[model samples]
Target: MDEQGVRGSGSPPTGRFRRGAAWWRSGPPWVSRWGAEGGRDGGAAWPWPSTLLLTVFVLVGSSFAAHGQEGERAALDPFARVLLLVAAGLLLWRRRHPVAVLFGTSAAAATYLGAGYPYGPVFLTVAVACFSAVVAGHRRAAWAAVGALWAAHVLVAHWLYRWLPPTGDAAVSWGQEAVVLAWVVAIMAVAELARARREQWARDRAERAQAARRRADEERLRIARELHDVLAHSISVINVQAGVGLALLDSDPEQARTALTTIKAASKEALGEVRQVLDNLRAPGEAPRAPAPGLDRLPELVTQAAGAGLTVEVEGEPPRLPPGTDLAAFRIVQEALTNVVRHSGSRHARVRLDKAAGTAGDPRGAALRLCVDDDGPATGADAGGSGNGLAGMRERAAALGGTIEAGPRPDGGFRVLAVLPLDGATAKEGER
Candidate 1:
């Protein structure tokens, strides 16, 4: 085959050859045509065999051609013809064991050259072997082998004809060889870069998916904490009232009726709160319900604690708060007082809410502070160590852009202090 036919043949079908063929075909029309044909016919699988067969056919045809010039011979010698046949046989195993095929073909070509074979057909076989190596993902090995073969070619050619130096016409030939080698290297590099980029994209997509899942889990946990804190406190109060009613049934009918009334009221309120929470979960698209207990409900909350047999006191005017901050402030005080009733072993507790001008001197915002103190014994224990109660309180405050500190007070009590942002764009304008 002519050089144009050889170069135009592009790559082959299947494996790495298909990738190379697709890349090469993305060029001019001639390359595309050859690539389409070669890729469809698996030309890359046994390229050397196909090339050698074509060479033999051409040589035979050339022998029959009219040649008026004197001392004109065929394009290949007898030994060279035999070597090409051997190289063709080796091509069958190229894909399975490209390294072995490359070495075998290289040795045969060198021997054919040593025996004075015509150089053209032998060079084509060497190029096909090198191409096979590249398609097998062994570009470095192919380059190394080609370099060794070129060095050997220079030495052998010089020994055969001593007057020929390594430069001049030979140097020009080497330059052309270097260009071909560079082209092959570029192809391999491009493939490597494409593969690397694909892997990076996959990794980034996986990380984003993981982040989404984590956020969903956190939201679910927050909802669960809300349900537990609200329901547990209401149930505890109902349980206390019911016990009181049972104890007074025979001794004092009037007191028993009052206790029963308190139980019914607490139960109804607890049921309403629970239904509202469930509705929020089921219909997130629905309009939000009226805001839960905030500063306005502080007095009612304090009254309930007093009814539960704890002396409760309130101090300071709390700032108007954003909806979320308001809910968080109420939850903090509610949880602190609940702990006092359940575990403090104390009779009196104090709640103080304050709003003041910012220490940073910003006109647009103010600080809302809450402090709940109980004259309970030093129950020096980790909040998390006991139950989810205090942890739920902390999470509530933190979610509303606030900070909470809870521990035993130095003066024989437990104190919880939460500072929340108020007077922001979200807060009512006239109230700050």
Candidate 2:
């Protein structure tokens, strides 16, 4: 087959085989797309290359052995040369049809020996075929083929020597059989080792692919959470201000203008934050280290809530927290107040921040606490939420080894309480 035909597709082998030795490794054009057999590891056109080298080695080595063993064995004739070629040629299909190729190589080698051709590198063809078969996940078939060849050799060398060529040849000694047995055992041992190594490499590659997929999934989830927090809180305020603006557009033009002004500010801030998040996605390494929203931005959220007509009460003081805990705290507060504005009948909500007393067996700076509350008969029975806001809040808290408790209070209101861990989360972030 020509180079293009054997390659199946591509510019042709270029680096090592620039001199066009491809024909030495390939057969007829009809079988060029060898890897399409659906059970091999190499490309569609590149079967085993070593098969050609083995052919050359066997032909040359057998010629030298023939002269040395001329007195004791059948001369290397044209027929013997044909057998050598047949054995080596069968190995070309070993990758795609390992079992079949092994069977063919073994039969040809056994026939060559049984015909009393001088033994030299003839057995090497069978050994190469068996090694390829075993490494291709066909160990049982390889062993069977090798065992069949050994059995045929025993039959010829011991009982059928008289009928074989080189008449008057005596039965081979038991020591020669022992040597053949050892040789066969060694071939199987090396092949088995190679098979194990291939399996291990495949497993390692699969594990690395799985790990890459897992990291991508995590990054996607984090970006979604950031977008949800930025949009939901900002959009909720815009929704409130737009409603106020429309209600007072005719009778109270100044109030309407004030509400529209708030809408513009809220939208501008939302777009800026959204752009920051997306810029990090598009060029994460080069994006500026703009500070992420944290409790430091808590007062800005309160100002936005006031414009939306939800009067927010503040208590206690925000702490200097680890970046993870700070961001989770900020998002949790923003989402809670957003829920109050969107779902509750009450226009008043309270937010409190405190350095929490750690849970049992934990250090003092181990947690920060946030609480948001609104007196409410909600707009509906399911006024809780129908979106990712609450779920995103819980995910953020849980990721930092923290907890969020958002439920109805006994005194007829909704309350969201979050306790975020400090020390462990900081350590984990540093490790990352």
- Top candidate on lDDT is 2
TM for candidate 2 is: 0.88
Q: Which segments of candidate 1 are over 4 A away from where they belong? A: 1-176, 290-292, 361-365, 378-386, 423-432
Q: Tell me, by TM-score, which candidate is best.
A: 2
Which tens-of-lDDT digit does each residue in 223-323 have in candidate 1? 77777767766776676677778998999989889888877877887888888888888997897585576777888777777666778899987666667
Give residue 49's lDDT in candidate 2 (0 to 100).
Answer: 55
Q: Candidate 2, residues 1-432: lDDT per residue as tens digits?
A: 111111122133422222334554444344444322222244334454577788889999999999999889999989999999998888777766778889998888988998888989989989988998899888889888999999998899889998888988999899999999999999999999999998999999999999989889978999998998888888888988998999999999999999999999999999999999888988978945688889998899899999988899999889888887788899999988888887777889999887866666675356888999888656643233445877888889888888888777778778889988886898766654
- Cα lDDT of model 2 overall? 0.81
Clashes of each: 0, 0
lDDT of 2 at 47: 50
Q: What TM-score would every model get versus the actual structure? A: 0.58, 0.88
